[model samples]
Structure formats: structure tokens, C-alpha cells
Target: MITDDLIVKMTEFNAGDPKRIQHFIKVYEFAHVIGAKEGLDENTLRILDIASVMHDIGIRPSEEKYGRCDGKLQEREGPAYAREMLAMFSDVTETEIDRVCFLIAHHHTYENVEGLDYRILLEADFLVNAMEDELKKDAIITFRDKVFRTKTGLHLINTMFGLCSI
Candidate 1:
């Protein structure tokens, strides 16, 4: 129920911004698929879902305040909103909320990533971003090499971008 609630909250938060809402939803779905394929446990999968949905939550505030939404600003501002949103649900544990917030804050960092949830979240975000940005094959390949870790994430990238051997 909290997961469903989060989705609705995210949708409401990005109201009138179809692009942002769609982006987060796509990222959430991709992360779910990849996490399942990777055999992530329930807890990690839940965190990945939350992080994916709230990862770019800082964008609106960042754009409003700074007239732009960059990775750093998103990372810097996201956790507070994530925390506030997560607090609305009583079933979400404190540790779980903290971990989700941490993942949201570091989702764009891409370095020193320590967990499956984090890696999948990053991969899911990149998958959507590559398509939305219309990145070249070279760039996608570079990102696959540089950022991808899990087998499922790599496979999705290869398949989505036609880098796989058929």
C-alpha cells in the first residue's frame, strides 16, 4: 500500500509535468523488472522502487530556485522531500526510509555504489534517460561499460540498444 501511495504521491507531486511523471514511472518499472531478474530480495526491491520514484524529486525545487535542475542539485535537495513523503506512511520503517533517502540522494552519483538496489536504480534511470535524450550508440555503449554492473541491467541495455548478439 505504501508503494501504491508513493506512486500516487509522485504523480501528484509532478502534476501537470507529464514528462517528469512519465520519466519516474518508467524508471520505477524498469527498476522493478531488473531487480526481479537480478533476484533481489523483497526489502531491496521495495527500496529500489521508492528510490526510483523519488530520485528526481529535487528537480522541481531546483528549477524553481536556481532556474535549472542539475544532478548535484537533485541529489542535494531530494532526500528532504523523500523523507517528508516517506514519513506520511506508517508502515515504512525508519531504517528503510533512511536507506531509501540515501539511495535517492546518491542515485545520480554513480560512484562507490555499494548495493544491488542502488545499481539497479542507476541502470533503470540511465535506460530511460538514454532513450529520452536520444543518446548515440557510442554513448550508450560507454555508459554500459562504465556504469552497468548487474547482469540483468547489462542485458536490458544490450537488448534495448541492440548491442546484443541475436
Candidate 2:
């Protein structure tokens, strides 16, 4: 399966860096949970899974080129690396590749989201990032209001970050 292949390749691509490996793996896991709970069809789920694993594929290259891996750099350098890594698999269709690449390119852009897959990727990455980055309550609430739309994604953000007084 491409998911398995992606895991292996992502792991290899992030070798010797447990933090990077764990970040992608955690993002993939959250994306899997939210995608399934949100009832994404098989095709969308597959693309989400692939995109989650390969979302940060540009981090290394960005850091190498610009000495930092900010959102713009990742967005700029990610699609090409993602395309190359995805090309190693034969089952992934051109449409799938295009869609995943699109999601990766826009994952950091919160406004003008165009699809469920894109929204979920942002939610999933934010879910992991909230904890990884130790985001504060105000930022979490602001993002929850501005970015999150799906029921499942919003619920996860609220519960995970204690946005609501329960």
C-alpha cells in the first residue's frame, strides 16, 4: 500500500532525526483519526494519509537552503520533494499526486481553504503542532475560531487544548 510505502520513505527521509519523524507520524495518526471519523471516502483518505506523511518533506531542504523551515519555505519547496517521493510508488495516480501536492502546498495557508482534505490536513497538523509547539490558550482559541470548520476537527481541538470549560 502507498500508505505503508510512504511511512517507510518518510521515516528514511527523516532518518537520524527523531523529532521530525515523530512529528510526521503524529500528524499522520491524527489525520487518520479525524479523516475516518469525518467519513472521508477511501480515495480522499488515501490522499490525506499520503499528504500528512509527506507534508513536511520540505523542511530539510528549506533549512538547507534558507537556514529555516518556515511556512512559506515549506510550501515553496515541498511539492517538488513530495512529487519525487510519491513517484517511487506505482499505484498513486496523477490526480492523486496533484491533489496531495496541492494540499501540501497550501497546508500552511489557513484562509481560502478549498476542500475537506485541505481543511483536515490543517486541523491535523495544528492538532499535533499545538502540543509540540506548546501553543497558548488564546492562540488556540483564535485558530479554532478562524480555521477549524469540521465537527470532528473542532471537537478535537477543543478537547485536546481545553478550549472549552468542561
How badly does each model clash, as a count of residue pairs? 0, 0
**lDDT tens digits, residue span 92-162, model 2:** 99999999999889989988998889999999999999889898899888888888888899888888876
Best by lDDT: 2
Candidate 2 TM-score over all chains jointly: 0.96
Model 2 segments beyond 4 Å from truth?
none
- Distance (Å) between predicted and true CA of 119, model 1? 0.5
Expressed as tens digits, the lDDT of each residue in 30-86 for candidate 1 is 999999999999988888888888889999989988999899998898889889988
Where does candidate 1 have its weakest 10-residue lDDT segment? 157-166
TM match of model 1 to true structure: 0.96
lDDT (0 to 1) per candidate? 0.89, 0.90
